[model samples]
Target: MATSVGDTLEDDVVAIPWTSFCDKAFNCLVKHKHDAAGSSLRIYASDFIRVYEEILDQDLLLERCKELNPDLEVTAAYLSEHLSQGITKALKQTCTAATQEACMKIVTCNAGLLVMQLHTMISGVPFLWEFRMPAQTASDAFYRHVTLPMIVMIVGLQKQQEDLFALLNDKDSEISDYKRSGQHLSRKHLETKVFDAGRFRRETLTPKHLKDCLSNVHLNPFGSEAGLMYRKMMEAYKDITTSAREPETRSPKNHSSSNIPVEVVKETRETTTAMDVTRLEEEPKPHKVKKAKKRMRL
Candidate 1:
């Protein structure tokens, strides 16, 4: 059950009816029944304990803090007990089915406030977590959770990009070999242009492309016509490659030498050469032959 508070004068106190609260809640829930779910963080109640424990590990906290102050008053046992109690209380508070839904709203509405809210919920004391953390511990946690991990991810992504570029170069070489062998694509539009990474990145990172990505966040990528066509094309390519891997088996009766008759080919070439020679000779001798005919006539 949820409750709402109403405001009034200092001396006057007014209580809103429970029915009004229920009505408002129902309407609000229905309005966003079909949330877009783009760029939103979702954490289920069932996984709350694991999520909470991941950040609040007692040994890790103690080790990180101990480096700053060797005489630190907080012990591992105390930290563990404190975390256990807070987690239990937080779980009890968010045991309801709608807790996950409320989390989604909070995450999308004001993500910055989420950390504070979680601190309050887990500690059962507002802002207590802030004062407890020293500068050293806070920095270490930030580096571990945010900075270092991000650096690692960037490095991995760069390596993957290099691999992809190498693969594209190999494909370009294959296409060049085909061109050199006098093979042509059946469709002129199918010919690919040389790739320019800078231009491609500039074109892909446009505001319109960002909007398209956001708009498609909730769509099923594999449900589109382009996806179906891509699947069919891959299937055909796979079949062609599979067939190419197998050795050709030719029949003994159908020899390569018998494919064309040698005499017919020779005669055709001779006839073509003779026709060309006759035309060239006639062109040069036409005036001479005409003069000779006039002399004979005279």
Candidate 2:
């Protein structure tokens, strides 16, 4: 950990704890959340480097480079291969050696940075690289890293919502056309209610609802069914993006009429017709009581 004092000098910097930094960032966000017309906060790339070096004290290995140039470049293939191998090795060692408490301490104290534990392989040779990260960030770092990205993400999601709403309306129009042409749906359960975006925003998009969901973060975000669901969603997204495309034609077995028994088909037809008739007959009819005739026993 690094410590610094506030002064109006060239090398003056104040390093706060990671927890305190986060708290201060959160309070700032909450204070300015409703300031919609206010100008957005300005951030620079140097802010990231400054916090990492002056606050976290992690070496980024820039000093080791010739002339301390930050614009050093490498081939993408080389970079990816070395990064993957290094991460695999690091994860194996960490999981095998580190305890749960030790892991938590690393996150809290060191700001989740693995100091000087990475190695890069080049031409069948390995070399140590001290690619460090900031343990303690600046007060506005959260806005740059988290809040700005979230605002952009919300804008994207709102666009997606509008697109979906338009699609639903088009679908409803097609369904209405079918109905106007005297075409009926085979099943009542297939009919969907009209989408109400206003209702959804009122009921689900409330600040209280969001606050309640965020309040449960302390109870282990990845140690519940929600974590499993998140993994499943990621798997689905991966499959859709990377898997091979499906065939255009349907399989013959799916539409084969020979698979159905005659008795079952007749029963289904009769049941559907009976249901339709009952549904059409909305008027209630009076029921007459039948008089019981006295039985003469022989």
Candidate 3:
């Protein structure tokens, strides 16, 4: 069994043993049926790897890691080396694809749980689920790898179509502080910086800067296209916020509003009036005695 440097072996380690623990855990999941085809250890490994990869690909894992160690430089290289290595090792041991997939899921879940447990132990914070990297580094990574180049390409295309729109819009300017030198800056570079700075500001500083950067009204064709994308992104953010704030249970008044209460009230009143008229008709009416008097006179 591979062990880390700081970890001390407990007495249980010697007596109960890792092998026994694994066997028990595996058996607990899949009853101790000895058939190799039915329940293999590799299944767990594969499941664990799949989950681990998914988490790694998402921003949540890096965010969680940052929460744990704020100063740690969590580069893509570091992730591939340390975390991915552990996952690969676990996966490689599995003999079958099905077994491997199962194990990957288990390992990923276990890893996340372990991180949470570790954070709790270290910081006494129960909900430290995501890790965050340094603001500047994270911004750089996001722009360089994801949004930066795209924005740069957009700006470049816009510049070719319209000269007036060449200037960085209000939204871009607010997110980024310009370092003016004698040399002119390229459209691509400016756009890249804008996107990166915007993301950085969102994560670390206030998002108010984003409004300023986006406020420039001069629309090139490319700018208009980008604006639509930006709006969609904002909508998604709004939806997330709305979902979080939405009440779990609605009020009785709200529930009743779905039915046509005004119509119901009108129907009720009409029914009452009709019943009253029917009751009046059912009552005996007084008969005139004129006909009997006339007969007596004749």
Candidate 4:
């Protein structure tokens, strides 16, 4: 009698040995259930089921089993164990082609419920197995999908932080340059220096001293003598103006006429024409010469 499609696939699947993987997967699932809380267990179980379903192919399983034991009608539990063993053996032989092919077939052939249960068992298998070795020993698709993105995000954030630090450093340097250009000290450096509050008080309280201090502070130390002289003159004028505003000083109109010095008024005019007087004094006076008359008796 010709074997049915399901029987044939099942026999073929059973022929492939996967005992080690099945035992490992079962133990892992039991441990997972034992360690996890009720809520967590549900989540982990669901994930495991999904992975198991994806690794076990029903159609190929039935076909393979039918080829293996055509005369014997296998029960559901037997079929399940047989498929599990086959997948485990396939993963052991070569996790690259065989495992992937088996997983793909399972996912395609099984219904949603069966797929979930199968994947639960398959995912429980250890990464490094004593019996079966993985084909591609490097990272898997799961690592790329899950672990790699997380790593990339962390590295990206670190780079951004470094860039922010660099930007802050650049800004600080620019600020320092601006302060130097403006004839001002850096705030950071200023904080480290000792300040004389008394000096600041003395300078600010007096307008003359304030002007002098401001000039000295603002002007370049290498400025021309003329600039220094101008600053001095300004300070002198401010002092005079400030002195005149004192409470004890009398107004100009209230001053007595006797307070004006006669010599001061006269000397002011003399000094005004002193240059011309000197020029006149330096000129030579004309001499009167006596001439002798010659004989004009004719």
Candidate 5:
């Protein structure tokens, strides 16, 4: 049985609710099922999982953190522990069959909190996952989809890494950025820092990029469950893009009488000048009205 919450630490440990976690995972799965999975992430849950897998150690995770953004203050132990707890929660809840309607049925409970004398380290985001009311849409999508999967991909972790590799070897960060963009893991590893909430913030993520990524995955000639979500997203993107471009293309073609070009107006003025000259020649002048006045003067 999982505890509803974990023990508070001297270091900041953000507590994610079991109901919330499952809801997020299920929504992610459904969204992917409607647009199938492209990725997975975890760790006692850290050491237990790490005991087997030969991926990078905490040093690499922390190294990546330091390389990408010096300002981000996260530690490998903190991240690993969080992953382990998440995995622990996921393992307990995910094993049993469940439905979207009954999503809140499972909750995550922390077994206990242990503070060691030697290796004690504190870590995690200060944001408190403090998403303001009506959280930004991009941040929400990122958390539900990209964030979780990307972490797994970055960490090279699966829900059950305990079985993937022998428990004795080591792991590195060389393959951290390989997320599944298509039939295989994507090689286009964009260098982004891990666990920076601002990085996952709405202003940073482009929905179109994610849409493109998701859409390309569905076109994987091989069968996969990336449903019409990608197609729909593309359709939506196409519709909006086409609609946006339409006005720009037609703008120059829109001509009205009031907006006649300068050349045309000049030509019309020249034609009027010729017609006035013709009318002057056709009109009779005051023939000899001055003759009588000139005779009287003589």
Candidate 6:
């Protein structure tokens, strides 16, 4: 519901509808999908927030999922949780934890489907069939807010991260940007925006509007660790771009580069952590905080 001109979406931000997202996902998985006797979509999705808070078995998931919609076919079952908020899709029902390696495969193989899913989460009105995301904590909200835009900015060909948010995500930030003359954008001010955390499908945020909300990579966000997460994504892309352009160079090639396809290098949102960030030592301290706050954001 952001009405201010600053909140308007940039021309580069792509619009995605929920139905289009799911249909594309279904088409991509049609090869692997089959009708299961008792399979359901509602079980695991009954309430994502609660399910994520606890460990669950496949049978219980089937009962709940099937009860919600029997005909709904899942190419891959979301068998396990990744991090606190990451629920992964897989083919098996053994409740195996989705490995980062597998996520890496999805990134390489079905990036379009992945980006579509992100689009659904970012803008589609909160609906049931899509993964029912629950906002429970600052970290959850923070990841939701940043992850959507981050994907479009980096993985997308058409969409780019808005200038406003990009300024905050800049790997190199200066002290004077946050303050000019005697003005200071206080920690409280940053937290308000971080907590405002726009993850809902209907709400939109623009960079010009975010200038009042965002700060350089100096002062830490008080609530969510989105600041830390962005830096890691930027850093990881070095290897991602290198691998995409020439996967063979990074590892032994089973096929020629021409035969192998390059896909979006979007890292699994669940797999990214603060530990993955290696630039903390190089970043100059924010004058506002004696020491930088470092916590897992994604």
Of candidate 2, the 10-residue stretch with the lowest lDDT total is 270-279
* lDDT (Cα atoms) of all candidates against the true structure: 0.30, 0.32, 0.27, 0.29, 0.26, 0.27
Q: Quote each prediction's TM-score.
A: 0.31, 0.36, 0.18, 0.18, 0.16, 0.19
Give per-residue CA lDDT, model 1, range 1-298, as digits (tens). Answer: 1110110001000100000001111111000000112211111110111111023344564664355334333545443443333332332333244442111112121212222123322112121231121122222323322232233334444555777877887898899999999999999999998776787779878988788656733232222343333333323322332333346554545333231223322222111000000000111111111223222110
lDDT of 4 by residue, 82-121 (tens): 3434333342332333343233111221213322122212
Instruction: Put down candidate 5 lDDT per residue, 82-121, tens digits, no spaces.
Output: 3333333332343334321111222222222211111111
lDDT preference between candidates 1 and 3, better one: 1
* Tens-place lDDT digits, model 6, residues 10-29: 11111110010012123221
Candidate order, lDDT descending:
2, 1, 4, 3, 6, 5
Put the candidates in TM-score order, highest first. 2, 1, 6, 4, 3, 5
Better of 1 and 6 by lDDT: 1
What is candidate 6's TM-score against the reference? Answer: 0.19
- Clashing residue pairs in candidate 2 are none
Query: In candidate 2, what are the lDDT values of residues 83-163, reduced to their tens digit?
Result: 334433342233223322111112222444423334433332333444344433555444433332233334445556788
Worst-scoring 10-residue span by lDDT in model 5: 271-280
In candidate 6, position 245 carries an lDDT of 42
Where is model 5 more than 4 Å wrong at Cα? 1-72, 75-228, 239-298
Candidate 1 weakest ten by summed lDDT? 11-20
- At residue 237, candidate 1 shows an lDDT of 25
